[model samples]
Target chain A: MTYCLGIVNCFGIVIAADSRTNAGVDYISAYKKLFDFSVPGERVLLICSSGNLSMTQGVITELRRDIQNHEEVNLHNLSSMYDIARYIGHKSRQIQDRDRQWLERDNIDFQCNFLLGGQVKGEEPQLYLIYPQGNFIQATKETPFLQIGETKYGKPILDRTITYDTPLEAVAKCALLSIDSTMKSNISVGPPINLVMYKADSLVVRHTLELRLGDPYLAKMRKLWEDFVRQAFEAMPNIEWQRETEASVEDILID
Target chain B: MTYCLGIVNCFGIVIAADSRTNAGVDYISAYKKLFDFSVPGERVLLICSSGNLSMTQGVITELRRDIQNHEEVNLHNLSSMYDIARYIGHKSRQIQDRDRQWLERDNIDFQCNFLLGGQVKGEEPQLYLIYPQGNFIQATKETPFLQIGETKYGKPILDRTITYDTPLEAVAKCALLSIDSTMKSNISVGPPINLVMYKADSLVVRHTLELRLGDPYLAKMRKLWEDFVRQAFEAMPNIEWQRETEASVEDILID
Candidate 1:
């Protein structure tokens, strides 16, 4: 399992992912799920993947091979973020097509999902959640975030906090907190979190951080968030119990 | 779709549920999911249901009918909370068994789940999650809460705050917040939210609330929680950026 999120707002874009993957409870391992395929001055592109390890690796390898081999259509050459998303979705579908039969024969799930966030030279920063079926949906002004893989446990916070005009740095912090919430609720999503923040119109990636297991920053942030959440909960007003006597009085009056 | 939660701590048991039911987006209606069958001064029995509307309704109807008709084995006659859980599960299984073939022919899901929480005269208060297969598991000291239906959105807070030692009132508040979080994230779970709080050894339930749509208290709590959560997020420490120059120096050293 994996949890990857991409947030695109007026200020910039933030993409984050957890590194843990498990074929089963006993077969868990850490892997880099975020990849940077930026051209520095040309465009900024980041992809976060979740689902079948072999299938995603195949898609990533093929994408890199296309770039290294300078194939006509590649991540570096795509003119628009939409086109790049389409290319990644196409590659994902291809990998699934190649292995779906074998996986199905063994009753294994071969589906994979990807979150592609980037900015091309002329367009605004964009985020897209590419489906396993080669379809994709982009984030918009009203809903400025997209998530994939173990999504629900971390979604309420995003729904409550993210807006199109949120500051870029604050969005990054929310992304980390979102993943931290998921990690606390689910064992499938663990650490070595990868985060990248790309400022709008920059056409380059400058800020990146990888929080490994037992990272002090991660521990400190977790402790602080937990404390604050408890404090917030404690601050919530107590429930006003509706007394049974009053209800009975109302009931007798109705009768 | 539904969201129901039951939290059992040393102080007492709190059970809460949303009242929304839907066949699809087009067909949403409200029905009470929390039912009290408490024989005051004897047992405090509260049950919350989730899953297929017809199946859960059928289970509830039959449980009521058995008690009304004075059947040989009824909920009122059950000696322990475990037996009561088993009795509810048995009724649930019977309903599913009756409808299984017809539902399967149309590819409809016939499964249902129940959270039965209460105390019998001789036994301590208990909470059990009864599965579709007529089996159940009790909440334990290590994990003092059990939730059914649309549970994930509200789970992080529970994971962060709930324990066996939590006060009953606080647990009740947590249950409300948990359901509120779910309602915020999902449209299928909505008001009027039903809540029941039972103090240990008080077998009779004296505190309950049904928060309808646009209830002032509910609105106020929602606003306060949003404010507090934002304040909490703002209070969180910002990420310390690891400069590219530092990373490059470390890379040079490694090389």
Candidate 2:
């Protein structure tokens, strides 16, 4: 029950992930899901994970280990965004191999998914949704954003709002609205959000900020959105045909 | 894939369901998911099914057969809304008993769920979410709704809008908003919505409306909601404290 979303806009890339992780209701804890792998001015990539905490953390650690030994393939050494997806797949597969047998024995699904996006020094910004099976799909003009875990509740706003030509700031707004919707419905997705944005071509990490508990702006946005929706609900016209026990002028109809 | 929702409002009840049912993309068909049994002034019962179409259809058929047989237990003869729930559960279990052995041999999990809500003569209106296991839970003043199948996309707006005391017309509006959101994200849940409403204690249905693909009012509401979201998006502040590319804002200040 996690939420991680990434959007590739004309100006750059936007990445957002919630911090809640749970093994069960009692084991709930905060775990940072966003990882930065880019070298300033050389490459900038933000990767977010959602699902099996153990499996995702395993993949992240594997990537970090790969980066440490330049001889091994990793995000820092990869020349293109597509290679990033392959490398992530390879690592995820490696970890799945270790647990696949055990997971099947217990009837526990080894479920995990990830959103990997950012710029390599030479290429345009890119976004990819890496599935639990160690395969991945890159976002294109038709689908300029990718989400992983608990995605449906937040999808309509994203499907309607995001575009390849959208400005970076507006992308942030869409991402937040998406998160706002998810957090409102799911208790397991409580947030102290990890939000990051990378400017196109600059290849350096520009904004990698965390809004922890008690963050003012998120609180304000939640209230403002709720208030707006309440007002909108009131503004909708009452059904012209429905009757009242005690009829009023609004209930009157003419044929 | 399907989406079905039910709402209990001050004026009455609103139930709406999509008509799409698919075994696979190539096997998709339009099958109605909503069924109502109303005996004017005596009782009104609405049922929406999501999951295995055959299993749900079986349950529907069994209930109708009971009615045809003049069975002692049917919505028409049930003493209270809870009794109606038990009847649905009993029949659902009967269907499962017939199907489970064959389904298990094929290695497919048992999949089915139902949401039943309405009023019987001499009893208050009630809503219940019936599980495949024959257990049920009723909605309370704090939670005045139930949803079945592909439910998440529509759930957020419900969290933001529905209450036990919400007016009947407003409940219908909210139900549309909910189903509309589900349809926007899920292609498997599509057009020709079946929406019904019942006022408390009146027994008979008050409104059983249809919203088709080209319905003008629904189309207008979708556009208005999208526009309103766009306006709300623009009103939010662009975080000024975001780091810049020329020099890391952190480097400039921290150094």
Candidate 3:
């Protein structure tokens, strides 16, 4: 399993991914899941992928190949973030189609998903969640983030904290914390986290980080978050027990 | 979907459940999921259930009927908490077996799970998670909690705060927050939360709560938790970006 997410706010976009990949317990290994396909002054493209490793790696290779070959419709040639999302989704479908039957024979899941977030020179910075079925949905002001894989454990914080107007740096912090929460709760999602922070109109990737296992900063942040959570929990008001005649204790009941 | 959990620490055991059930989007309804089956002074048995409504309901009915009919092996007659867990599991298996074929014909899921927590007079306070296959695992001092149904979203907090030495009230608070997190992240798990707190030697449950939708305390706690979380996020140290000369931005990359 994997955990990857992208956040787009008024100031810019932040994308992050965990590095753990596993076909089974014994096959667990660390593999970078985030890729940069930026063209310096012309465009900024970031992708985070999850699911069948072979299929995702295949899609990424094809995407880079299209760019290196100067294909008519490649990530560098796409005019809009929407088209890039569709193109990635299309490549994903083709890869899955080629492997689905053999995988189905052994009852394996052959699907993968991607989070596409970046700016296309003349267009606004946008984020899209490309589905395994070759369809995609773009983030809007009301919903300014997209996540792929192992998403739920880290969602409550994002749901409560992120918004379109959130500052770029704060958004990046939230993204790291989100991945941190996931890594803490699930063994499948381990460290060597890759994070990128893009300034909305710069059209050039500036800040990127890779926090490997046992990194001092990661440990410090985890410790601080845990302390804050414990403090917060301690501050919650205790349950107000109803002051009534204790209900008959013999009333063993069912719903 | 449902979210039910049981946490047992040295102080006692805290059990909680959310009351949302749905067959389809149009059929969502509220129904209690927590039950009290304690026979004062002899034993304390609390059960929280999740899964196919019909199957769980059937299992509950059978358990109740066995007790009322003065069967040879009813819950009150069981000498140990382990036997009670097995009895409940047996009852669950029976119910599923009876309904499996009919449900499977239409591709419906007939499985359900239960979290049983409490103690018999001569034994220690314990908690067990009964699987759909009717096997159960007891919570140990090292891992003091068990959860079922829509569980992931609510798990991180429990992982961070729960332990054998935590206070009973604090454990109860953590259980509520866990369920609250799940409700916030999933529409399938919703309001009218039920909670019960059992002291180790006192077999009868002295404290219980039923927080209906829009309850003042629920709203207050949610607001406070959100505030604290935001504060915690703000307190988190900003990522320390590597100082390497910015990598060549033209390197459109793969892998």
Question: Which one is best on lDDT?
Answer: 3
Q: Candidate 3 chain B: minimum summed lDDT over ten consecutive residues — where? A: B246-255
Error of 2 at A3 (Å): 0.9
lDDT tens digits by residue: candidate 1, A1-255: 899999999999999999999978999999999999987667888999998999999999999999999999999888899899999999999999998999999999999999999888779889999999989999999899999999999998898888999788879988998999899999999999999988887666778999988989888878887787677667777888886554432233211
Task: Give the alpha carbon lDDT tens digit for every residue of B75-168 in model 3.
Answer: 8899999999999999999999998999999999999999999999878899999999999999999999999999999998898889899888
When 2 and 3 are scored with lDDT, the better candidate is 3
DockQ of each: 0.42, 0.35, 0.44
List the candidates ranked by DockQ, beginning with the highest. 3, 1, 2
Candidates sorted by TM-score, descending order? 3, 1, 2
Off by over 4 Å in 3: A243-255, B243-255
Candidate 2 structure quality by residue, lDDT tens digits, B1-255: 889988775556788899998877788788899998766666778999988878999999989888999987776787888888998988888888888999989987667899998887667787889999889988877788888889999999899788878777778888888888888888888878888877776666657777778777778778777776776777776654455557753443321
Model 3 CA RMSD to the hidden true structure, in angstroms:
3.7
Best by DockQ: 3
Give me the overall lDDT of model 3: 0.89
Q: Name the lDDT value of residue A113 in candidate 2.
A: 86
Per-residue error (Å), model 2, residue A124: 0.8
Q: How well is candidate 2 docked (DockQ)?
A: 0.35
Backbone collision count in every prediction? 0, 0, 0
